[model samples]
Target: MITYIEELTDQEREAIREAIQLLYRQTYLLERRYDRRTEKYQYTKEYRTCSTHLEFLKDYFAVAGISLEENVHDGIIYIQGETLWGEKLPRLATVYLLILKLIYDEQMAQAASSTRIVATAGEINQKAGAFRVIKSIPSPTEMRRTIALLKKYQIVEPLDILEELNENTRMIIYPTVNLVLSGDHIRELLESFSEEENSGEETAIQNTIEDLSE
Candidate 1:
């Protein structure tokens, strides 16, 4: 690996280093991320860097028992492993994630071309109320913090200032939502909520966040 890297140009080496650090921080890197300022998707340089050094990255992450994978069809690159470092999401964040996954699925089913989906803060609250996932709507401060956390990990991107988030504020739900929880897991959790509702009980969704980091 050293010999191969030594043969690369200085710029390539620096890019590879940056790519490594980026993966460590975010776990997943999309080839194209939504740019609110441009109102379009733009190619990510880190993704290109990772693609250029795929083999080296695979070998490097292997030492830590993390498996680096790329989905060309979806333009996503991610790492997964039991040894991965992760964050313990707050209950509200976990609930929001579940709602986002549902929204993504619903949008994808109706989408004709683009996979990029958009949703509003009001819509999220509506879903939460419909599902009875939480007893009441989250305060603006709670919503801001939750969105910021998910944005940091590339799960969602705000279309407006987070501080001013309200029912009408918009956000771009990234495809990375699919990686956060499998379809089966999502169904299971939703079913559990349904059963609890039927039984006149409340249940909180439990997530270890083992697959998400930083």
Candidate 2:
């Protein structure tokens, strides 16, 4: 529960709004599954629009020296350009990673390979904490961005799994996206980030002073 919000300029808030909107959109578009037994979807079902999620993002970012501000038209949000908290959208990334973790857990339980199962994004969101899954899964664009970020940090990598097709002209193969996570490594990264975030208040104060002077 870190709170990163502070007053922000129109320009900075707009950037934040756009980024969060992108995140919500991307998370919503991920592939998912349906459980006939439950008569409903399993992964993520539905989530708030970008604006709704902004409330939480603003709080999270505020703890890290980044505040959100709305544009004059109130159609956009702005954020500090710097990586105020060392990581961007930490909550969102953590949520996506948690989804991957859940998928891994399910695979292990079923004794199936990653490529052998189909998971719906809806299910993931449902199981996630409100703080994490503010909105449903991200859209494709957001997923791509998340993937890029994960790859950039080497926190996760695309895993290749073998798929097979039967000769009966029936589809028998599941094309699941593979995810790899080194818990120890990821834990270390989070710990370091937490440490950095502890000093976010000081940073925000300094940034505010700079803003005023400018």
Reference-based lDDT, residue 201, model 2: 32
Off by over 4 Å in 2: 1-89, 112-122, 129-132, 136-140, 151-214
Worst lDDT 10-window in candidate 1: 205-214
For model 2, what is the error of residue 37's alpha carbon versus the real structure, in angstroms, after optimal superposition? 36
Residue 77 of model 1 has an lDDT of 93
In candidate 2, what are the lDDT values of residues 20-132, reduced to their tens digit? Answer: 55433221111233334564434422222334456777676677666665442212334553553223334455555545555555665787443433344444445453433
* Top lDDT model: 1
Per-candidate RMSD, Å: 5.0, 18.0
Structural similarity to truth (TM-score) of each candidate: 0.83, 0.27
For the record, the alpha-carbon RMSD of candidate 1 to the native fold, in angstroms, is 5.0
Q: What's the distance in Å from true for residue 205, model 1?
A: 14
